[model samples]
Target: MKRLALTTASLALAAGMAFAAEHETTVRMGTEGAYPPYNFLNDSGEVDGFEIELGNELCARAELTCEWVTNEWDSIIPNLVSGNYDTIIAGMSITDERDEVIDFTQNYIPPASSAFVGTSEDADLTGGVVAAQTATIQAGYVAESGAALIEYATPEETVAAVRNGEADAVFADKDYLVPIVDASGGELMFVGEDVQLGGGVGMGLRESDTELKASFDAAITSMKEDGTLNEMILKWFGEDAATYE
Candidate 1:
């Protein structure tokens, strides 16, 4: 009887420890460390970008010890639901389809346009071979707009396809492609009208993580209220870019 009591106590203690662990203190922030200007690996090979800056600020405001984790964009949401990370800080636009699967904080970045770039000034805007990163809103738009869509695993690969003539053009977030076009020295240029899709970008969280979502949402609200988020938008996307305001 004494041995059984000791064993029961040990199991109860272990269960308590597990319960405590479920309420993790440190929040693991996830990002796609490949999207330049939004999130990317810097020369030092560390994740660096506007999202990284904003996420760190949010974490600070929330008084949470947050650590960054990189994941490919293709499987980012699935992985988040699987508990590979606690929160997704990538530049993911809030959409109804996505909302059904996961929860989002209020948008941090305001809605931005998506544009198509091609080598030819007169490239066909419709029914042309267009490249876009797989599973992105841009890809869905391309596919639905009577354009022949070719999906690539990464944004870089989609751009490469256009450059190599594998695709007639590439469609992506206008802000993400603007700097590339500018630096291309006339090699690349926008050829079609900018298409606006999806709501503004927000941090993704599992539906079960209501408390964590509230913390991030509060941080974002604080930034918006203080004009810091607008400042960040201008710093990263230029003065004309959209903001929470």
Candidate 2:
């Protein structure tokens, strides 16, 4: 899930392509198969993650035949517009900028916080080098926060930027950072208060695909209403994660 917030040009292109293929029955779900717990490639090189499992369930509920497609975060929206995929099932935030280009199903995941992390607890919070994945919300925030923002193509590189002293800290989703910090064996720790950004995460569809959007919206609502959504949250993001209910 790249914070690759939506783009206007890409969204328009995607809408046009989708209109031409509106009658297609097979749904291709696009995702960044690099963000863990959201969507990522398993050791077997298959797309697997919290969003993957949840997406499969949603497809089943919608009675749609779903196929997974991996894409880079930076060009995800443009790719979707080009008919590279029919829908985006990545952990994409529902923001007005994104809404301008593509339609969204009702939020599937609740709002979540982004965390700051570094090797030392006292790492610079301002005016210091900070790293974030390119096109992500974290990168945007860092750029505006007066920090020296070094952007990378992938989340893994952002973490690498901090470890190699290219940056003093990294800004990223708390859930993504938690496992890294835990596995760092005391080499890393979170610093600074968590920053909440964007609206809840949702599935992205072509603006013209109201029927597809409605189908997924109904499925998402069913999960939230039945508590299955919250269960998936606990399973993926831990009990402390905020739930819909």
Candidate 3:
């Protein structure tokens, strides 16, 4: 009888320890470490970007310790669902299709979409055109019109296709592609007015982590209120680009 009682006490103590560890509030964050100005490896080979800074700010606001892990963009969602990470701070857009699989925090940035086209005089993709990258929302826009589509694996590849006159245009997030455009030496232009994608970049987590989601949402809200978010935005994208509502 005494042995059984001791066993029971031991089990209870183990359970308590597990609970404490679970609620210890350490956030394991994931990022692509490829998307620049959002999350990427800097010249010093260190992980540094807008999302990285924002993650630190959010952690501070929530009083949580954060550890960042770099992962490929395509695998980020799957790995998060498999418990490889606690949250994804990658510059992931909050789309309804993605929401069906994982939960996302409230948007922390304004949505900005644009199209890039080659500078060649013969290349013209204007007024309702197709885009490279079929899985993207831009592909959906192209499919709506039954237009011929151009597809590629990465934004850089898509932009290269446009520059090479293989593709008419590449639709992508303005913030992600704007730097590439400037570096292309007038080889690309962001045509037409910006398209509001109706979703902003946010952190992603497993659907079962409701408490963590709530905590992250609250932290983001606090950062916004305290001007920490705006400050970080300015630091990365300059003052003009920092003017986000």
Candidate 4:
């Protein structure tokens, strides 16, 4: 009877271990895979970008397995609220308006000033016709400043508009627009000083998921301390673009 009881206890312990091993918290992350150098598809059609690398690091630090879901840029928040994803890791800026609907982790990436680029070498539309993605901070700037706002669905569209002379200049985050400018082979040039966009990139979590948000904030802090964050930034944007401060 003693041997039988011991065998039963061992089986129970083994079953508990199996259950624990099989149970892993999965986090569904959303991103618009069109933002190059942030979260875009590569030539091979795989998601290979800065935000993707950073997301992997955050998942590792939090001890969670992440499933990335690509969505349209405009629908990222609506889909998040509709239960399409648990968190948003796209290069999303944290703003007062967004805060009303979702909670954000501490700024993992600081916001760089926005810049305007034009096709003409002497394109002096510093305060003239401005093109930015609709509903974005850049658009807000154009609206407030009374610039002719040419709205586009994506950054690529805005860039294309400038290249095709459909718009005078393209206004967007420097990190996103710089690569496009370089790739345009001198077709685009910076028109003016960078415009301040008072926000930073952060992980967007549902308001009710405070526990998950806290975990993500802690993981991001730990990664920043250990230099893992810097390394990934460098890998994506080169050494000069790794500033987190």
Per-model clash counts, in order, read 0, 1, 0, 0
CA lDDT of each prediction against the hidden true structure: 0.86, 0.85, 0.72, 0.78
Rank the models by lDDT, top first.
Answer: 1, 2, 4, 3
lDDT of 4 at 10: 45
lDDT tens per residue, model 3, 81-189: 9998999898788899989999999888866564545554444555433456545666666656455677665556777776666676777777777788788788676
Off by over 4 Å in 3: 1-22, 120-122, 126-134, 242-245
TM-scores of the candidates are 0.90, 0.89, 0.80, 0.86
Per-residue alpha-carbon lDDT of candidate 4 for residues 137-223, written as tens digits (9 for 90 to 100): 888878787678888888888888887888888888888887777887877788767777857889998898766676677667666
Measured by lDDT, the strongest candidate is: 1
**Candidate 3 Cα deviation (angstroms), residue 130:** 4.9
Worst 10 residues of 2 by lDDT: 1-10
TM-score of 4: 0.86
**Cα displacement (Å) at residue 133, model 4:** 1.4
Q: Candidate 3, which ten residues in sequence have the lowest lDDT sum?
A: 11-20
